[model samples]
Target: MKNKILVLGSLTLLSASLLVMNSCNSLPKGLKTIQDFDKNKYLGSWYEIARLDFVFEKNLNNTTAEYSLNEDGSIKVVNRGYNFIKNKYVASTGKVKFAGDSNEGKLKVSFFGPFYSGYNIIALDSDYKYALVAGESLKYLWLLSREKTMPNNIKETYLKTAKDLGYNTSELIWVKHN
Candidate 1:
């Protein structure tokens, strides 16, 4: 009877996890992603100018992310950052694939196998030099650029865009670069 109960509990947990994963594909009301995104143009290195303080990347600086196309059509994601407190460089390699169609800018990225998080390109400059990325909810947001520091005008615009999307722009932690 104990074994049966354990099995039932495991199945229930698995179902809930699957449900959450599926729900990540849809953005909450009032949030939208860019249209006609070109993955090839976006492939390259990006510096994280600002971000929310998530556990995986808390207290990090000089953060950068590189993207390249894998032979199998998936995107290879390499993230590097300097942990000031640890006095070391931290890195994580992952894979990203479009959530629905490549043109939509909605992506699913996985650092740990089979477990993906949302990577929605909510905003992008016309030249593709800067971008704003969002995750499954308002708690996750990132401002990225080809350079370490973005212009004040651009930064204000992106912050405003995020604010309009229900994110708390004041909570953004600017990443320092050496």
Candidate 2:
């Protein structure tokens, strides 16, 4: 009887996990991601151009994210920034993996163990020099570039896309680079 209960509980837990993970895939209609994303070409450093304020990144500047391939086939994520409030630099390391078997643009990133969040590359430049990323919702969005800054035209283009996707573009905090 005990063994039967244990197996049943295990199956319940697995079902719940799947439900929670699927919830993170809720995206607005007409919001499309880049196609044929090459993970290898995207492995590098990206400067944060703009983002919506979040606790982990609040009061930060000169923010950057670096991605590299791990031997285990996961992506190593390194996020760094200067904390003006703390008057120091802060960095966090994380891991990322594709959410689907063959979709390189949709990823799940985890900083705290076993707690994953969506990391979708909704828009990207052909040369992989610029990208617009979104989380599970419109509340989590970021604009990234290979350089410290991006051209006005590119910024406007991304902003328009975000606006079209029902995001509040005015709430984006433009990141400062030093």
Candidate 3:
């Protein structure tokens, strides 16, 4: 009967959904939020220590991001980098706005048209020496610094932190600078 066919179709769709989730293709495991992100001290230059090899900065060196508060209560985000392979300097400007009162550190940034994406300040050092950023998902984590280089111990600690948040540290692409 029609009811029997409908039931079988629903079961098949449910099994397919479970199969896709088990594959782990899109959504990833990652941290939820930063305990307390100091807005004042965190607004400054931050070098890209490790990234997910995103297209915006592929083969780029001396990658750095600068954040400043705008007059309109928005965060001015500027990402600059030198492309070693292309022998060029690239700069992309964007705007970041806070989510709401309940989501202080959670933010939305727009770089490619009207589509805004999550940019959360997951972890930060007391002195702002290092920071862990989550770009909406586990596959979009980044280790940043005020300087071009990070200490070995610091790198280890950061990797561990990222791992604890359900991220795979081995997938991180270490960005080398000139």
Candidate 4:
């Protein structure tokens, strides 16, 4: 009687958790999973050229990301930036795990939540000169580079890739380097 009731309650909780997880992120038809990203080339510093303007990083500039391999085989994503509004540098650390096709350059990242979001690498330079990132939707896009700015051709190519991925490139805020 009591055990049966407890079992039923546990099952209900698990079912609810799964539903919540699925509802967290709305992915596109061919959205890449954790298995898509390349870990070796993915590591290093990537400058933020544009983004969808999350409130946390709003009014921020000189944004950069430093990634490293953690002890547990997870990638440590450390995003640092200088917020003009807050008048201070902010750092956000999050863990990233691979899903779907690891070699295909697609991954899902979570920032301390059960809900993992898309972090796909749609374009990258051979010399690692620049990288174009597309998040879960048409709004989440970023262009990064080793230097503060990139060449016109590279930038154009990246922008076109973002647009093809269903992002509105016009909204990309040109990051002002400090």
Better of 2 and 4 by TM-score: 2
Rank list by lDDT: 1, 2, 3, 4
Q: Go through the candidates in order and give each one's C-alpha lDDT.
A: 0.91, 0.89, 0.77, 0.76
- Residue pairs in steric clash, candidate 1? none
The clash count of every prediction, one per candidate, is: 0, 0, 0, 10
Task: Encode model 2's per-residue lDDT on 15-80: one tens digit a residue.
Answer: 999678645565556776777988999999999999999999999999999999999989999999
Q: In model 2, what lDDT does residue 126 have?
A: 91
TM-score of 2: 0.86
Candidate 3 segments exceeding 4 Å error: 1-30
In model 3, the worst 10-residue window by lDDT is 21-30
Evaluated at residue 63, the lDDT of candidate 2 is 98
Q: How close is candidate 4 to the true structure, as a TM-score?
A: 0.80
lDDT of 4 by residue, 21-74 (tens): 545244554544333346877789888877778776788999999989999987
- Expressed as tens digits, the lDDT of each residue in 4-59 for candidate 1 is 99999999999999778655586746878889999999999999999988998987
Q: What lDDT does candidate 1 reach at residue 5?
A: 100
